[model samples]
Target: MTDFISLRNISKCYSAAGRSVFALKDLSLDIRENEFLAVVGRSGSGKTTLLRILASLEEPTAGEMRFRGKLCSPGNPLPSGMVFQDARLMPWLSALENIIFAFPPRERTAELHEAAKKMLETVGLSGCERSMPRELSGGMAQRVALGRALIKNPSVILLDEPLGALDYFTRRAMQRELIRIYLQEKKSFIMVTHDVGEALRMGTRVIVLGEGQMRKEINVDFSYPRPRSDPRFQRLIDEVLDAIGDGE
Candidate 1:
């Protein structure tokens, strides 16, 4: 498979209190087309910063990124769409309208509406098109956000701790929903999550970020709908935790 996304020698730094804080240092990664990759890390480990750079939301202090073998430039419509930790939906807009917000307003208004509604349905929000963000539950709101991201039909999807705020059941349900979408859409997915188990369950490959760099990469190599109690899955979780220097 071809490389859909590539990052070479990427680094980011911010000056704080007359000192420099290194968020990422010399990180290099390649995401193959249609691959589902998860990045797991502790707070301040630079996972979010890496995703921001990939999404073109922030420029890296050093190194380069390429999309579809083309050099990525500033102001480029990133070959990807992003979902943040919060739903970030406009409170006044209905679910369908929020998804439509990303589309260009022209003769395609009706086409965009149809696409948005289809995406909402794909995310399992079929009948909630007219629902406002305030009227929806947290999981429902996040589903709307997912619909918004998918409606754009980007080649890659960047999820920045998007499932972090949900309760256990909702979070698990969303994880399965995300996996289902990944399989159905076959679009590359790069998610930054702190949940190790979720990472193990969802990612075909898991990358661990630690101490200002990517510390480990583990391939799950298991079939989909992975069971939580499987020995291999549990072992992978322990291994990822150990990579971050965490104890059992």
Candidate 2:
């Protein structure tokens, strides 16, 4: 696999209450193309901080991040789009408009509408283009959010707990949707999810972090639509739980 993103000795620290708080410490990892990398860890493990640093939303206090052999900057950031836990859609915008808003306002045109419409279809929201955020269910709203990210045709997509808000059934359905999108789009997707089972179900490789450090990296060799009842699947979950020191 070709390396898409590489982080070398990445560290992030902040001063809070006269104490130096380190979210990440001397961390290094490589994300390859077309890989679904799930990041799992306990609270304060710096999972979200890692994602934000990669997204260029936060500046790392130390270390370097390179994308495809080039240094990354705010202007020449990683070739990716991001989705948050909440759909974060514009309240007044239609689903299609929400997708279109991902592009710059200066770049908005009739052509972008057709592009958004196509992405809406791609994300299984074919008939809901005109639906406002108020009219859409939680799952449907997230679908719109996913559309916004995918519409950018990014080489990588960063998701920070993108499905944590949905109902159990809706979350399961969206999990399948995520796998389907990953396979169809073949983009490098790094998702930071608290749900261990969700990570095992979706990721090609799972990275476990603890106390601001990488604790484990496990490769899920199982195919999509993996059976949790299978012994291998359950073992993987156990391994991840153990990594987070929450074996259960």
Best by TM-score: 2
RMSD, one per candidate, in order = 1.4, 1.2
- lDDT score, residue 234, model 2? 91
Runs of candidate 2 with Cα error greater than 4 angstroms are: none
Q: Candidate 1, which segments miss by more than 4 Å at Cα?
A: 106-108
Q: What TM-score would each prediction reach against the true structure?
A: 0.96, 0.97
Per-residue alpha-carbon lDDT of candidate 2 for residues 170-198, written as tens digits (9 for 90 to 100): 99999999999999998999999999999
lDDT of 1: 0.89
Candidate 2 Cα lDDT to native: 0.93
Clashes of each: 0, 0
How many clashes in candidate 2? 0
**Per-residue CA lDDT of candidate 1, range 79-184, in tens?**
7778888999988899989888766575355567778889999999999989989999999998888888888788989999999999999998999999999999
